[model samples]
Target chain A: MSQALLFYFFAAVAVLSALGVVFHPRPARALLCLVVTMFALAVHFTLLGAYFVAMAHLIVYAGAVLVLFLFVIMLQGAGAREIALHQRFNIIYLLPAGLVSILLAGGLIALIRGSAFQALKSVDGTAENIGTLLFSQYLLPFEWTSLLILLGVFAAIALAKKDAA
Target chain B: MIPATHYLILSVTLFSIGILGVLIRRNILLILLSIELMLNAANLNLIAGSAMHGRLDGQLSAFFVMVVAAAEVTIGLAIAVLLFRQKNSVDTHEIKELKG
Candidate 1:
């Protein structure tokens, strides 16, 4: 019972914060909402027994990536006023929006009705298990990921560096 | 007990919101943020499915997803910074010229 409650709570918060990320007028405010969504999803990860992933989500997403986003927002001096919102509603867009929402709802229903979700397994996806798997069958991908990070670092530096006139 | 369906539904909901953000927002930074949100939704699905199947593969994939997200964010923000410097604005509509 409690687990269900927690799931509902986190899910609600995640969805709401995600909406805020989409609709918030200011970029900085939207970034905050994005942080909240990440935190809520981390809690969900924890509940699902992915403790290591939960922590990484918090650290890498809320900590590092979001900090970069905030820094860029600050560097750009708080957004241009004209671009705060891109869409002005027209009567024509209403039909597409409604259709998309309906399709999304149908997808949700199909997901819930699937047989794979009928049983709840209480498995522990602990960090130790993940680490074991990471080193064993997943070792190749693990090494590749580190190399990708290295490439990303160099790419970021090259991309962001100012050019001489 | 919370079934896996609940988590899946949540993931879909979050993904839809991210899609909305990407579609509606003009600020390139916000669009990147939306992309992150979508990636997190995918991570949530991986973790939940891992729990459901009694396997660590889902969690392992989530780990990889995080690594990819970090790399993408690094490069994306760097581009955003460069765009701001060159164009003086980060509006998606404004940076139309390819030469810059």
Candidate 2:
């Protein structure tokens, strides 16, 4: 009963913050909403028995990616008037988008509910078990992740570098 | 105990919200953030499935997805910064020079 309640609470927060991310007029505030959404997701990860992923989500997403978003917004001086979102208030566009989104979501939920996934066993999902799997069965992807990060760091620096004449 | 279908329903809702954000929002940064939300929804699915199946593969994939998300955000923000420097605005509609 408690688990079900927790899921409902976090899911509501996540969905609301996600709405704020898209519909909020101010970019900075929208970014904060995005952070809230990420934290809520991290909690969901914890509830679902993925502790390691929960911590990683908090660190990488709520910690790093959202901070990057704030940094850029601050540096760019995204003013209230400039990012006012007045121009994007077209009902014609929103009406169709809303209709399609509802249709898609309804169809998806129906399909998933109808599927048979009840007999599956639950895993421990402890950090040690994930670590062991990372080293043994998923070693190749682990190394590739490191290389991908290295490339990203370089690419970010190069892209944000002040152009030299 | 919460059933897996509940989690799946939440994931689907979040994913739809992300899609709406990407489709309707004009600010590139918000659009990117929406994309992150969508990715997070996907991660939630992977973790939930992993928990249900008694397997580690879903968590492993979620780990990799996080890595790629971090990288994608870095590169995307860098480009957003570059765009701001040249254009002085990050509104998607303002960027029309690239359209052929």
**Number of the top candidate by lDDT?**
2
Report the lDDT tens digits of candidate 2 across residue range A1-165. 887788899999999998888788888888899999999998888887788889988999888889888888877776343454466543456777788778877887687768777743557678899999999989999999999999999998887676743
Clashes of each: 0, 0
How well does each candidate superpose onto the true structure, as a TM-score?
0.90, 0.92
The pairs that clash in candidate 2 are none
State the displacement of the C-alpha of residue A24, model 1, in Å, after optimal TM-score superposition: 1.1
- lDDT by residue for model 1 (A14-64), tens: 888898887777777778888998899888888888888899889998998
- Show the colliding residue pairs in model 1: none
Candidate 2: deviation at residue B32, Å?
A: 0.8
Question: Where does candidate 1 stray beyond 4 Å?
Answer: A79-104, A111-116, B98-100
The lDDT of each candidate is 0.81, 0.84
- Candidate 2 lDDT, B1-100, residue by residue in tens: 6778788888988988888888888778878888999999999999888878878799889999999999999899888888888888887878898899
Model 2 achieves a DockQ score of 0.70
Fnat of each prediction, in sequence = 0.74, 0.74
